[model samples]
Structures are given as structure tokens and as C-alpha cells.
Target chain A: MEEVWVTGAGMTRIGRRSEPLPELMAEAALAALAMAGLERPEAIVVAAMNPEEFVGDGNFASNVASHMGFADVPTLRVETATSSGAAAFYTGFAEVASGLCSTVLVVGGEKMTHIATPRVSELIGRSIDPYERSYGATMPALAALITRALMARHGVGEREIAAVAVKNHAHAARNPLAHFPTPVSMDEVMASRMVSDPLRLLHCCPISDGAAAVVLSDTRGPVRVAGVGQGTDTLALRHRHDLTSFRATQTAARAAFTMAGFGPARVDFAELHDAFAPFELIALEDIGLVPPGKSGTITLDGETALDGRLPINPSGGLKARGHPLAATGLAQIVECVWQLVGRAEGRQLNARVALAHSIGGLATNNWVTLLEASR
Target chain B: MIPTTVAGIGEIVSYTTLHSAPEGFRSPLHIALVQLQGGARFVCHGAQTRRVRIGSLVAIEAVDNIYYFSSLNALDRARLFWGRAGRAGDRVNAMTRSVVRRLFKGGESGPN
Candidate 1:
């Protein structure tokens, strides 16, 4: 395989927006291409978790490519539910790495704020196992069940879980592109309305409308795609042996580390999928960045904060960064690129190697991608 | 595959009371993940979430293609039997037929 480098990364401000899905994606696409100093890529990999349901558009790859004025480019759509963006990135990475294409553009986005909250929940909930969904298990419901199990098994407290949201929101306050870019206190997060038992509204990422894009090429660039790995598990949550940790994430992290030729200790900072706040702590342990059962204590102790020893979610994470389903995975990668290149303005941290983790449906599909500044 | 069912008690592994339910579902929906005594596990709806504790045993009932779980009183078990036996037989039969058809078509084995 040939070497792959991230030439450029761009993303729109996440949250409710008036633009259509294609337009939002085009904006990010254009920005990324401009940053890469390229008119268009040899191939385009588009990702939208449920554009047919969320935006009433099918044949998304062709739709997005043409809309972005790359009408003749080879295009395809890649999806793994909520982690569609990262899946698209992997496709683009393969296209460049395998010499299928010299350059590729990977873009992902979602539009859901246009729908009612219940309807949005219903649509997103479609990702859940049908039997579980029939039991009225929405995303938060399933996450709550996991959170409860995590608490029971690890003695993780409500305060510890709530701290994830607090720290991310504080970090988001420094991020102009964040959805909830205002600081939220522990008292406020703890007092937030309960969406699902043991998981409050603050713990949940909002239904957002946004897009993110990245340009990849075999040519040397500022940031090298050090490693990328994907992992999948049984869709039904009941089939898994352990509820506290995600096997998919572990598998992906293992592959990523193997490719990077190093262990987790070398990662300077990370952008974690905190779609639900507890996931941050869970991802930390699953990726071997933190010792098992120590994530909660260190997180609550401010070790994962922006100025801490190992900053997590310097992009505000999916929590405050806004989780626009498919857009989230690419956004996380874009944030890593920004931080590595010293573009993450106020929330910038001293970093070189960065890792981005994304989860699809209920931790069933996960991806871990590592990046390093090409000095 | 042959059609079959598991009837027994299971412990609630974890549960949640959902305040903002999906469309066509009522708010404050109580859902639980249960691991049966025989080791089979599934998600089930609950009538009440109050007093429900993790590791507490609850009986499972199949009615209208959905599983309902709770700590049952004698009256509750009788009501479940009556509902499953005849009260909703026609509708349950229709759903069961669809489920069997889906299974034959290489779909999910369990009813949605």
C-alpha cells in the first residue's frame, strides 16, 4: 500500500442550520479543496447516514459530487450508520493508499433539525435492533442501560458521568464552531432534564445539521494518515458478552496501534466519540489510552481536560461539538487535523500525534484513526 | 429453523425509563434488558419501572409479538395468560405469521 496523507480538512459550524444537506456538504467540500489547493479530487466518497430519510435524497454520492461541481469525478457512498463519515474516510484512504486514485475527497453530513424531536428520535432509533426498538428503546434508552451497567459494575457515579459533559462544554466554550459553545457547570448538567434514566439531557448530543470534509492524497502533506482501522460487532446489544466496554472499539484501536507501529502511550491527544458523555470514558479504556476502570476517576479529576496531561475531545467532542450523525466522524477527524496543524484556535493544545474514535450504532460499528504531523 | 419460545424468569441486567419516546410511542416508556435463566437475552417492555432493580428476577410474557417483563403477581400472570391465549389471538396470529415468513426469507428470527 502507498502512503496516504490528509492534505486538507474542513467542517461547517455544527447545529441547526437553514441550508439543505447537499449545500452544507458542498460548503465543507469547497473549503477543503481550496485548502488543499486542488480543483477536484480523482474520486469522491460521500457519506450521509440517512439522507433518504433525513433529506429525501438517494444516490447521495452522485448527488453530492455533481452539486459540488465535480460532475465527472468517480463517486461512491459509504455508510455504517452514525459512523458513516469515518467509513467514507476509510474508503477514500484505500483509494489513495492502494493507488486506485492519486487523490480522494471524503465528505459527510446530516440534516435532522428540520424534523420534530420525536420524529428525529424515531429515525435515529431505526439504527437500533428492531426487537430492541419494538421495546421502545431509543438511542438514549440503550445508552442509559449501558450507563447503568457501567455504574453498577465499575462504581462510576452520576457525578463522574456528568463531568464528561462539563469538561466538554468548557472546551466547547473555546470553540467557535461548537454547537453548545457556552460553558455548562456541574450543577447545571446534574440539574438537566432526564432524557433516559441515569442519562440526562446534557449527557446526550443534540440532533444537529452539519457537514465535514477532508482531502486525501498520496502526496506528502502536513499531516500523515498514520493508521486507520474499522471494527464491527453483533448489532443486537444483548448478544455482546460485556456491556461496560465496546469490543468493536477495542478491535479498531488494536488495529490502529499496530499500523501506527506504536502503543497508545505515544498519542499526544485525542478526539473521542462522546455522543453520550459516558462513551468518552469508555473509549479511553477501550483504546488503551487509560487503564481499565481508571477513566472515570481521572476524567473527574480533570486529567482529560484541555490543559491536562492527555487532552480528550479538544474539539468539544460530539457532546458540545454537535453530533450530526454522519458528520460527526469526519468532524472529529477534521478537528484532529486542525489541532495537529495548529489551526484549532483557542482550544489548541500542544500535540503532534492525534487519535480520533467514532462509534456507529450502539458501539456495534467503530473506527479508530491516528494522525501525525509530517515534519 | 423450527419455531420455538423460551418461557422462564430472568434478571434485569439494566433498564431505563425513556421520557422522550419515538413517534407512536408514549412518553416515560420503561424498557429493560433481561438475561434469562437459560442464558438467552432480549430487550423487553415493562409496565412499571418503579421498584424495578438490576439483578431482580422478573417473569417474561409474550403478547402481540412483543415481550413484556415484570415481577408478576398471580393476577398479573393470569391476565398475561388470558391476553396471550385468546384476547389478542387474531392479531397475534397475523404478526406471528409475518414473523415466520420473515424467518423463512432469511430475516431476523425474533419479532419486531
Candidate 2:
């Protein structure tokens, strides 16, 4: 396998926006192109979760490339629900690793703010299993179910869950491009309206329109791709061996760390997918950043803060960073790159190795990626 | 993978009260994953009981081709007088009434 480097990282401000998908993607792509100082990419890989549902368009990869003014470059699109962005990273990595293309541009974005909340909820619910769909299981509802189980098993409570929101909000307060940057108190999070049982509005991430892009080249930059791995499980949570643990994420993290020849204990930082507040702690455990069922109180202890030991989600994560579905994975990668390059600005942390993890359908498909500072 | 169904008793491992039920579905819905007596597990739309706790015994009740977990004890005990049979009897009575109404309407064909 050939080595691949993250040469450039760019993204538009993550929040509700009115621009079209192609335009948003083009903005991020041009930023990456300029940062990389390249005239053109050898190839392009676009990632989108559901453009057809969002904008009634199907050929999104070509549309994005056309908007980027690329003249007849080989391009393709990858979609694995929420994990599309990470999958696109792997796709570009493969293109370069297999000696097919030297420099590949990977861009992922989504336009979801304009859609109504209920419609958005309904559409997002489509990614779950059909059997589960029959029971009308939305993502947050399923997450709430998992939370109830975890709370019972681990003696966790709403106070610990609310602490996650408070901590991420504090991190987002210092991030210029974060969607929500105000510090939230645990009281506020608990008092917020309930979106699902045990999960308040503050506990959930806001729908946003955003795009993020990265340039993967054969040349090494400040940060290089260390390892990547993926895993899958049954779509329905009922089929999983345990509801409190995500086997897909655990498996992916193991594979990625094994390939990188290091364990989570050695990782300096992580950008985990925390679409819901409790998920921050849950994913920390799932990726082996912490031992099983032990992250409940660790979150309350301020260990995952920006300057704390093994700071997680310094970019505010999905909770405060805004969740654009497809763009989230790439945005996480962009944050890792920025941190590795000493460019995270207000949220900078002294780090050499960073990890990013994402999930597709309710723990059905998951990906783990590792990035290390080139020494 | 091979498919199998568990109609016997099971235990509720985890559960949630769904507030935002999908369109066309009723809200405040009760859903749980039950580990069947034989070790197989599946999701069950459960009866809206006063309280749902982990490790509660439930019986598989079928209605309109849908399976649901009905609490074996109405008051949190493994008593022989399980409430599931009463619900099943109620469902049977409702079906009987519907069938009688259809018969009184001169055998008009309709979905059961």
C-alpha cells in the first residue's frame, strides 16, 4: 500500500444556509484547492447522503464536479448514509494507494436546514431497517432506547448526559466556525424540551447546511493518513447482541488501530460522532478510548475537555458543531488535520495523533480513521 | 441466515416510550427488545403498561400479523394470572364483533 497525506483541509461555516448543494461544495473544494496550491486534482470523490431527497437531484457527483469547474476528471460518489464522508476518504485513499491517481480531492456536504424538521426526521428515519421503520423508530428514539439501557446498566443519569452537552457547548464557544458557540449550563440542557425520552432538544444536534473538503495526495503534509477500517452489523438494534454497546464501531476501531499498530490509549485526541449528547460518552467507550461502561462519570469529571487528558470533540462535535449528515465525517477529518497542523486556533491542543470515528445507520455501518503528524 | 420466530415467553431487556412516533403511528408508543425463552431475540411493540422494567416477563401476543410483548403480570409478579391472556381474549372478542358486523352486512368481503 502507498502512503497518503492530507495536504489540504477546508470547509464552509457549519449552520443553516440558503446556498445550493453544488455551490456549497464548490466553495469548500476551491478552498482546499487553493490551500493545496494545485491547479487540478487527479480525480474527485464526492460524498452525499441523500441529494435526491434534499434537492431532487441524482447525479450529484457530476453536478459537484461540474460546479468545481473540473474538466472531464474521473469522478465518483459514495454514500453509506452518515458515514459517506469517511467512505469517500477511503475511496480517495484507495485511488492513490492503488496507483490509480496521485492527488484526489474528497468533498462531502449536505443541505438539510431548509427542510422542515418533521420531514427531515421522516427522511432520516428511512435509513433504519424496514422492520424497525414499521415500528416508527427514528434515530433519536432509538438512541433514547439505548440511553435507557445504558442508564440502567451503568447507573448513569440525566445529569451525566447533560454534562456532555455543557462540555461540548463550552468547546464550541471558542470555535469560530461552530454552529452554536454559546456556553450551556447543565441546567439549561436538562430544562430544554424533550425531543425523545431522556433526550432533550439540547441533547440533539441541529440540522445544518455545510460542506468540507480534503486533498489526499501522495506527498506527505503536516498530517498523513495512518490507518482506516470499517465494520458492519445488523440494521435493527434488536438483532445486536447488546443494546448498550455498538459492535460496529468497536470492530472498526480495533481494525484501524491494529493497522496503525497502536491502541486507543496512545491516541492524543479524537473527534468522535456525537450526534446526541450521550453518544459522546457512548462512542468514547465504543472506540476503546475508555473502558466499557466507564465513560459515564468520566464525562462529568471534565477529562474530555479541550485541554483535558485525551480531549474529544474539540470542534464541538455533532452536538454543537452542527450535523450535516454526509459532511460530518469529512469535517471531523478536517478538524484532526487542523489540530495536527497547529491550526485549530482557539481550540488548539498539543497533539501528534488524532482519531475520527463515524457511524452510518443505527450502528449498522461504521468507520474509524487515524491521522498522525508527519515527523 | 436462517429465520425463526419465538412465540413463547421472553424477558424485556431494555425499553423506551416513543414520544415522536412516525406519521400514521400513535405516539407514546411502547417498544422493547425481548430475549425469547430459546435465546433468540426480537423487537416487540409492547402493551402500554403502567411501568416497564428490565427483566420483566412477557408473553408474545399476535394481532393483525404483528407480534407484541404483553406483560405476564399486571402488577409486577410472576403470578399465574398473567394479563396477556386477558388481552388476547379481548382481542378475540373485538375480532368476533368485527366479523359479526361484517356478516350482518350481508357477507360483504373486506380485509380481516
**Best candidate, DockQ:** 1
Model 1's C-alpha root-mean-square deviation from the true structure amounts to 8.1
Model 2 chain A weakest lDDT span, ten residues long: A147-156
Q: Report the C-alpha displacement of residue B41, candidate 2, in angstroms.
A: 2.5
Clashing pairs in 1: none
* Local lDDT at B64 for model 1: 65
List DockQ, one per candidate, in order. Answer: 0.32, 0.23
Candidate 2, A128: how far from true, in Å?
Answer: 0.6
For residues A1-375, write the lDDT of model 1, one tens digit per residue: 999999999999999899999999999998898889989799999999999988899999999988988889999999999999999999999999999999999999999998988888888889999977877788899999889888875547889999999999999999998999999999999999998999999999988999999999999999999999888899898988678899999999999999889999999999999989999889999999999989999999999999999999988899998999998999999999999899999988888899999999998899999999997
Worst 10 residues of 1 chain A by lDDT: A148-157
Clashing pairs in 2: none
Best by lDDT: 1
